[model samples]
Target: MIPGVSINEILTLTSILFFIGVYGFITRKNLISILISVELILNTSVINFVVINKYLYPELLQGMLYSIFIIAVAAAETALAVAIIINIYRRTGSVAVRETETMKH
Candidate 1:
């Protein structure tokens, strides 16, 4: 439709990626893997914004700006999450989600 690429194809890929991220988040028990899954989900949103903006409003930079903001937030989130995970691991000697079930020692 648009030269060589179609919006549907982009949406389809984004949907697949989103589901994969969801599956990873639901099935993974490890902290790092879950973090990666969250990143994947965030990335899909970024892709959708970029693609829609590119096709619908090539003159505006709103989508690119939003994607940049999301990337910044994701970076900050990953840093904070990693720091918290490390702190928990140091105290509990494990990074598994099940180990954080109780705050009691």
Candidate 2:
């Protein structure tokens, strides 16, 4: 850990990772890849939230708590999404996202 590093560095790193994840989410055409990108983005924000709260507000871990909730929700979401994806792949020959959109309501 470099003592010379500033808070801005941490923020920048978090933002960069978030944007990369967003880009992945947008560009990926496979459901599995998109799900992975979502997780990446969620984790990026969690890292930012936890770091900000840890350094700026030590008494309250509200941000950390929110991150935990997000993790749980994301896990549940992934479970359902993967199951759906597997079903789709079994029925359809392709894992393309465009083919799965018809199932959406």
Candidate 3:
């Protein structure tokens, strides 16, 4: 146990968040919503890394480093995704997934 929180409790919360992200990704039709879900999934992973590292190996900075790297990657991913989505919206006039099936000439 670390301070007031247990590993099991942290794992459970992360699991729930991960599932919620998955559900959002699967159910949402909008491109922005899908991006949001992806971010949520990434965030949950970061949380898991931090919690596990804190409890299992408090002396090493590996988890924190990995989490920082993940955050950087997530930032880049979101920037690229948003740019693409914006371009798609500009061309199609909507950000819904269904609207992307047809190719524009």
By TM-score, the best candidate is: 3
For residue 49, what is the lDDT in candidate 2? 79
Stretches of candidate 3 exceeding 4 Å from the true structure: 103-105
CA displacement after TM-score superposition, residue 40 of candidate 1 (Å): 0.3
Global lDDT of each candidate: 0.93, 0.86, 0.95
Per-residue C-alpha lDDT of model 3 across residues 19-102, encoded as one tens digit per residue: 999999999999999999999999999999999899889899899899999999999999999999999889999999998867
Q: Cα lDDT of model 2 overall? A: 0.86
Q: TM-score of predicted model 2?
A: 0.84
**Poorest 10 consecutive residues of model 2 by lDDT?**
1-10
Q: Model 1, 11: alpha-carbon shift in Å?
A: 1.1
Clashes per candidate (backbone, < 3 Å): 0, 0, 0
Q: Which one is best on lDDT?
A: 3
lDDT-wise, the better of 1 and 2 is 1
TM-score of each: 0.90, 0.84, 0.93
What's model 2's lDDT at 14? Answer: 87
Better of 1 and 3 by lDDT: 3
